[model samples]
Target: MRLVHPLSVVRDAQDWTYQDVVDIVAKATKRSADRRKAWKWENWGVEPDAESQAALAAALGVPLGEVHRLGWPGWLPDGGPVRTSFPWTMAGTLDALDDTLEHAMPDRRGFMKLGGQTLTLLAGQWLSQTPDALAAAFAGGPVDEQLVEDLESGLPRLRRLEAALGGHRARLLLDTELATVTDLLKQASYTEKVGRRLLRLNAELARLAGFASFDAELHAAAQRYWTTGLRVAHAADDRALGANILKSLSLQCYDHGLATAALALATAAVEGAGDVTPRTRAMLLLRQARAQAACGNRVGCDRSLSEAETQIARSTTTDDDPAWTEYFDPAEFHAQTATCYADLHRPRLAEVHFTTALDLMSPAKVRDLATYTIQSARTHTALGNADHAVHLLERAAQLAASAPSHRNTTRVLTARAELPMTKKDPKVQRLDELLATLSA
Candidate 1:
């Protein structure tokens, strides 16, 4: 889960034979990389010798000494097809779309290990990319504008499904939808206008799918989906949505305790959010605040949160914001801000924002409500309000049971474990029994 060998990413992109790497290394270094050694080098946790690694690096066009600095797979290309690396182009986007469609189900590895170089490269590419040539038409079934619009209209419903069910239950639907769009892109012909819209739709779908995977805690799937989404955004020339994807990736990193990488992605998201609405900008800023808090940058976190509050108020009056961002109203802003305070260990302030978030949050946002409820319970525990804390845990447990999310289940367990009086409090003891059933 941590170290994805370059053999997979590069071989898939270049259609290299299994022995190709062995041959290349042998040719470069005149070293013995036999079949067993090559097999270990390509697919497992085994580290190749320095000389062999150098030879492979050379073959991949990586700097020779990079092997020593990054140490094995860290020095390898991004954890994706090499062609989709950077300087976004139509060809790269198309290849990503096709690859996404082909692999609707990535291996659900338990951890996400996005290298620093990969994340940095993607952010740089998004910020630097401008309109390239439109993709040439493909030879497949004919696709009309009407079908594309119909798909576009249905996107909101899918988003709702993901929000309600979280990624575990909803990713299959999103992936299917993504596949349909990819089919249209690759198997049909359309006008440039239609093509652009289709690409935009695909990009959004990929983003949703990626987040769903993240929500479900399928880390590898999330990385693949998000990376593909970023590439599709480049094709559609939609930096706003691309920035959102970057933020999503940032959240993934932060949740996994990758503060520095998370900060990098969040910084890029804020910087690359070009010409977005006030609300959208607020969303990006809020994300930056969260990343800053994760990085222990109290000053930066406070600054971003202050700016985000000002922008959220203005975003309310505007009607031109993207539909995917409709969740970032006043209620969600409090929830997000509360998240930052929780990270900063300002339990009292976190309680205030969580309370407001709970009051203003719509019933439809079950997942968000559940998340805030659990965090609220923790804050109450810190404040020595055991009874109130137990009450919140009860509500959070209800939401988790009703929704059936492994991620939420894990949260419920963690929250229960953190309760100061879980052993002595009868209500908490009963809660532990209930928790047993949930975990089971």
Candidate 2:
């Protein structure tokens, strides 16, 4: 059996230094370690205490027993073999889809540590046109306009639910709907034209499902669903939807700190967008700007943002735009800009855009408002305005109370973790109390 080093496992799973791991372990175990000892243990090997093992599992975003299983001889007796790879099949995809839908996501550490081979496999899966065995399992039945209308009508409601509540519930609902659609497509019959339309609808649902999963912080599931959606889009020859999905994948990569992958994906989205409307084009360009910002290409980022603005200015109607793109307005544009600046560590500039974004915060986009509030709080903290940061966090907390988003909660906790406040501070204590309730 190959021996796996604990530090190496930590490095593969998350972006944290040795000291960071030591600090987390110390806090979890209620044991203090000097820097020298921490470095020595990290460089060597040591049996972890119970709390340290639990903390390592939490930090690596896996089950506690999984951590015990990582060591040779399997320290956690009776535990099953640990999965060294993500499942790569239709059944695996559906199972993961169901998991995301029915359960809260696993701890979502970012994706900078994701292996290059994983990215390659995902990209290949997305671009491949191979027939799925599941599609062939059931006989086809008759397709109709009524069926299409029923599916289409449900879309708006899912979008609303995701916006009003959070991604976790919405993702589950979509997964159930998608399972039904998959069954319909497998068992139901249709003409070539109708089949194409149904495939397009399937692609849309898959893409939305992926977005909901992402919002819920089910990162790996989101990537898989997005790839599946892209495959469906290609079956329908829906280049526009394909581009949209590609752009979304790029955003996911950017969120995970894979800037190079993000830039490549964004570029692919823009190049393949074909005859998409100006609004759609603008949205894609904004995504490119985000990727560029992540790559620290300030000039390129500025150019992309400028191009997006020009495209938005020229867009008159959404008639040519896809239904999924109705939310890309001035406020969203400003919010994206603020995020780019925030990523670049330009808090002053981020502050300017965030303020404008707050002014334009649409009442319908509760989750977006909460996200922006947290981003604004981050900016305030960066600018040494702890008081203002606390105020913004309070507002965010209030919004989160009504919305109940896992993503928002994680962001709030992460931002709070960065603050200089000790547990003795009232605000810090309040945050801890709030987090307890949220996790409950």
Candidate 3:
């Protein structure tokens, strides 16, 4: 997910197509427009002159230095300093994460990768329940069952917060709660059975944090947290949880347009989900459909989607599903099907599914409504319904005014960018103005 150039930040921030930036740069620099298309695709790199760099900096509303780093071209500061210094204990892990958030929170380029030390720490947590260590650690206070129960009870509410307020608002809160839970795990000693449960809960917390980070577009941070969650899940021997995390990673890759990587990951998710509940299986299949669509595998996409729907129809509540599996429902199936159709450019089918999903969505799920509206609008725009698309876009804007998820914001912007209208179009102009004020 590393960006090739700093200008990619502008591309992401403004939701501008690469061609748009190339044209702007060409016009501003009085350069040949003939080279713009090739440059846009980066078939070959074009070294920007001083004037062109200045124009790009001004156009992107960033400092010139930020627009193009000299000598070495990377988001990282020169010489790559060590990002972690804490020990391998639970308290040390939390401290490392706090330090990570401080340095990486403001800029995606600054997000730290999971270093070897952190992996060693998680491996130690996995080994801590060995017979010799368990007997020796009888000195600490016994693990409190009540604290674990309290943490478990609050998860659904935290999930609801993520749904309503978006991941930008929930990431920090989830991290705070994770820190508290880790503090408990550090202080409270328990038997192997209790210890395993605690680790499972910690894994869930880390997975949620990763999910929030992914939604907020802190991509590298998301990867780090997701990998940490995977390690924790393996430590806990929670195959279902691990599969779910891999599915999330697949979705992230699909969103980034890495269809090949996404397909492999989604396939791995399905393969790794041994003896999974039906609902979880269906969700994984839906993710597989998305990845297939991204890869231009029409037949494979349709087959996977059919299997997903059939599995959804057969799913039942008594399937012994994980708590996270509760969120997937008939409406979600329809919404995801709409996404698959949208990707395949089957606009008519996409419109039908998106409309039905929207109708089924509860008003309480404001973020879902907003996201679906954007999806439906994209279908409409593809089908040559500019006015209808604009109408839906306005509704989406209203819904997003209160809850601005970075993921949804990017979707809306990309959809807006795809409209077959000139800059002079009033609706297009309005969208441009509206986007200028939306939170990034």
Candidate lDDT scores, in order, read 0.81, 0.71, 0.70
Greater TM-score among 1 and 2 belongs to 1
lDDT of 3 by residue, 176-283 (tens): 777776665566677666665676777787778877877777766676566556555655567778778777777877776778767877777787667887789999
Q: Which order, best to worst by lDDT?
A: 1, 2, 3
Q: lDDT for model 3, on a 0 to 1 scale? A: 0.70
Task: Summarize candidate 2's per-residue lDDT along 1-440 as a digit string, tens digits.
Answer: 11123353344446656677778878777788455544555445555666766776676566766666665213332212212133444444444444433332332322222333455445554445343333333356677777787887888887788778677777777777777776666667766666667777877888888788777766655665676676667666777898889888888787766888888788778877678888899999989899999999999998998998898888996357788897887889899989988988899999999999989978778788888999999999999998788888888887887887777887888888878777898877776777677666
Residue clash pairs of candidate 1: none
Candidate 2 error regions (>4 Å): 1-139
**lDDT: worst 10-residue window of model 1:** 78-87
- Model 3: residues with Cα > 4 Å off, grouped in runs: 1-107, 110-139, 422-433
After best superposition, candidate 1 residue 92: deviation in angstroms? 1.3
